[model samples]
Target: MVRVDRGLATTIGGAGVARVGYSGRILEAAADDPASGPCVGDWALVARWTDDRSTLEHLLPRRSCVTRAQSGGTSHAQALAANVTLAAVVVGLDQTPAITKIERLVALAWESGAQPLVLLTKADLAADAAEIAADVLTSAPGAEVMCCSCVDATGLSEVRDRLGDGTMALLGSSGAGKSSLVNALVGADVLATKEIRADGRGRHTSVRRELVVLPGGGCMIDTPGLRGVGLSGGEGIAATFADVDALAAQCRFNDCSHESEPGCAVLAAVEEGTLAVRRLESWRKLQREAAWVARRTDARLRAAELRVWKQRTKGSRGHPKRR
Candidate 1:
């Protein structure tokens, strides 16, 4: 990227930048700041660059955004990426793939207005990669699940068949060989990767969530390993866990938590083995986390909205607005 205006100028990168143009950050633009650098592959307002003017003027609007609940404070959804057309949930087959975790991430991706794909890597390590792939299909409906190993051309071919010429995000816990997969596909080890004990976990390699391009032609954004992804609480949550949510809707009380609730269809499904108990439990846990995030986000949003209204009210009443 060519340096321009300290941080307010424009960047001209090949391919990736050309495909997805620049837009400034939302929170920064909300505060009316001109220069906070463009938010990469995210929703932003874009303005024309004129000879007389140095800053952007109009917001192009975001196609979609991925977010998580505030980590520690009451804050609205933090935007992960904007205009993401596809999201690939990376799962390692070396160990039992947490279907729930995959679901939660998919939920976030769906919430962001992006279609989700499931990529199960490390077929060489998993006892039965094909079987696990089948299980993944059952766990997440309407998703493309691929079991692949970068060890050979066949596996690479399988993976290449899925990714299209669009922006796709790679999300999974570290050691899933996301970096390796990216390298193999690109026909080089351009991205850095490490190998630890296959059986053991706990080596923080990727720290920040940044976007990188796969060598071929498509682009991918690699994110830091997330221990948990909290949903922002909305239609996406219901859509991702439609099975559980549908059953919950059938309960006698709309406020049913599915725990000792009368006429709880969700619990009944668990009993009948129609829904895996573990899956139900996972859904419940995510619901709880989503609810928490919603509450915090609502609180944050309400505060900001109220402050805006308060300022207008004070200005109308001939009183100086409170700082």
Candidate 2:
């Protein structure tokens, strides 16, 4: 499925006329049909007959999925794209990149089972671009950090080289120059560009998540700017904060929260100037968010189970037993 808007699916290829599937049309086919609903970048099996236009027959198992907790007070998650191999977390150098935001996106990318790359865009706008990138590197840990200016075409080659022969997805807040980067990499104006607001935030130019084939033999998915990204379940936090994990290992207490606890290696590191207090605070905040999301997901699952049980036993108490 190339795009899914509302309940209508925009399908390309296969056979027959491209048919549009209405809301609940695909799910009505089978009880488990909803489980296989298409997301952006999903390789799905579709019925090509003229009568079955827009209906997805099945969604192939995803090797990886880029997901985050659904916004708005919901415990459910929203999958941004599926089967992405490279997740480029873009940040704008025009302003100081938020370490906490980068950490959260990197964790989400890691949790999605994709390799995360940190891209600092608008290199031409920042005099201290290198220093800002170096600071972000501490948050990204194992990920490679690259600075690129779409205007001057600096570091674009490195970005393309790193994306070699894999599906790469550009993710960042609005106004981070993700679309500009996509246009640069594609060598054409495939996506639109807009000016950053006076407040230094980006306008939401790309409203939908769509995939585009790159000139370099790889495909990419450009997503709209995200304001809030919540964590689902994954080891991304630990992976992003591996240094803290290592420090925690040496703490005298196994249950060290790294806050004012005695013999806390993490705190000790902060005191000794080995670790940045801001970094530790960001890690702790993300951990708490992840934990809260996990609890919410578990509660949702249990509630679903209880509902199923209630439905199954609705009239059993008054029914006669069959011999």
Candidate 3:
């Protein structure tokens, strides 16, 4: 599947096919022969081309993936997307973005095996860019926070120069100026913008996950505004708050939950003020979601294993049971 980078699909489907439009999402193979290899995931991107021309080719192996349990209470991990290099979460100065949201995205991005970058939008609207950016940095913990006023050419140029030639995804709540930043970085106003609400909440702009190529060189994947970001699995959570994770390892219990445990270094760090209480809470929240999802995924995996064992046993018995 092509990455969401808006670049034209690079064709490699053999002699008969022509690659056209490309997106990183890989739609599950509706029909397949299992004998050939392992099954691909169900939710894959539709790499489109001139009618009947586009086809799913080589699957870009995911270096890391963002997943959550299906809401239907099934033991399944539905992947949000894959093969991302950077998780670029945008925030606007016009009462739009929050440090907590950026933190949440940073945790998710860290789990996805991608670096996190916090893009501060509408810098011109802010009276104090440093104060706001500093807050974002505190939440993101060593993430790159660049401020840009889409109305200006210089700030936009710096953003483009840095984001150029990489695979980065833009994520933020609505009215965060994600779309505007994308247009500015691409060196063209290709994306549409809308006014934020009087209350400073985001109004929806992007509707789906689409990738666009920046004129400066990198691929930018823009997604629809998220309704919520609850994570599952100890994944990126552990990575994002690595200091906490490392400290937790010093705890007495091998599987320490780091909650009220004796010899809990995590708690000690909290007591000593080495870690922020809010960050710990964010980590715990994500860890809980991930653990719940993992249990569901494990159940599904076990059931699949049982089914396979039963099939093999039945087939062997039918073949005049081995002596």
Candidate 4:
């Protein structure tokens, strides 16, 4: 099976296009367009073209995909990257990291079938970097947490060492220093970086997602900073809040809501101070979002099916009887 390193989408005369990187050369290819356009880190099969124009035959199966609910009122999910092995949830140390946002992103990463790594960037700016890292570790239960400063290159080696010969993706909000971290890992000024504003928000320097080869023998996809991350249906919620799920398993009722219910082990844990109330609330909020997305997706699927059925039966209903 022939495969390329990076499948980054670029624009051609206002038309969305995809490029395949192979043997240190970039090739423009035609891709079988889907409802959602090709994303970074996608694996695709390319057809050899005699003419200058190349065609993307089809997209190969994705091992994993990082997706989020489309921002606007649309009930659609957007794919950030495809076939990612590691998802680095970058958070800036200059500001107090939002644990809830981290949890949400971790859930999305888990749902993508990739290993989630909580990365604390700009560690040099924060006086209590270690303390903040510890708090983030609590929010991310089963994932590895690391702190690094791009300015001094502290902990960059460790982060590079962890990404061993697989596609990794950088995910974070604006001003989380994702671009800086990418530049540090690649050891060059390949991506642009911007200064954080007085409001502590970083400018959106990366407008599109693109893949770059790491110096140490791996590829990484850098995505634009996310302002609002909504959840789609997946096992990420259960994985992010594994502690709460474990407690829920011990509940007397299999369908226990964990709210004012009899023999509710989850509530009991919260009452006994084992599980943090804030964590429980976050889990509940994500669960609700996931459920809503699932309903909307199902409705959309049903509507599509109905349209297909109507198209198939359209002219037949009005036809005259045949002998």
By lDDT, who's the top model here? Answer: 2
lDDT of 4 by residue, 249-308 (tens): 999999999999999999999999999999999999999988989998889788868976
Report RMSD for candidate 2: 3.4
> Which lDDT values do the candidates have, in the order given?
0.67, 0.82, 0.65, 0.79
Question: What are the TM-scores, per candidate, against the unseen true structure?
Answer: 0.79, 0.90, 0.75, 0.87
Which residue pairs clash in candidate 4? 30-56
Candidate 2 C-alpha lDDT tens digits along 1-323: 55667666666564632545644544553233232456777876765556544456766789998887888876767778888998889998887777888998998888888898899999999988888888888888998789999999999898888888888888899899988998999999999989988987777889998777787487788999987888887599999999999999999999987777899999999999999999898888888888898999899888978976776686587864431
RMSD after CA superposition, every candidate = 4.7, 3.4, 6.2, 6.0
Candidate 4 to truth, TM? 0.87
> Model 1 compared with the native: what TM-score?
0.79
- Candidate 2 accuracy as lDDT: 0.82
Would you list the rank order by TM-score, best first?
2, 4, 1, 3
Which candidate, 2 or 4, would have the higher lDDT against the true structure? Answer: 2
The C-alpha stretches of model 2 lying farther than 4 A from their native spots are 12-36, 51-54, 315-323
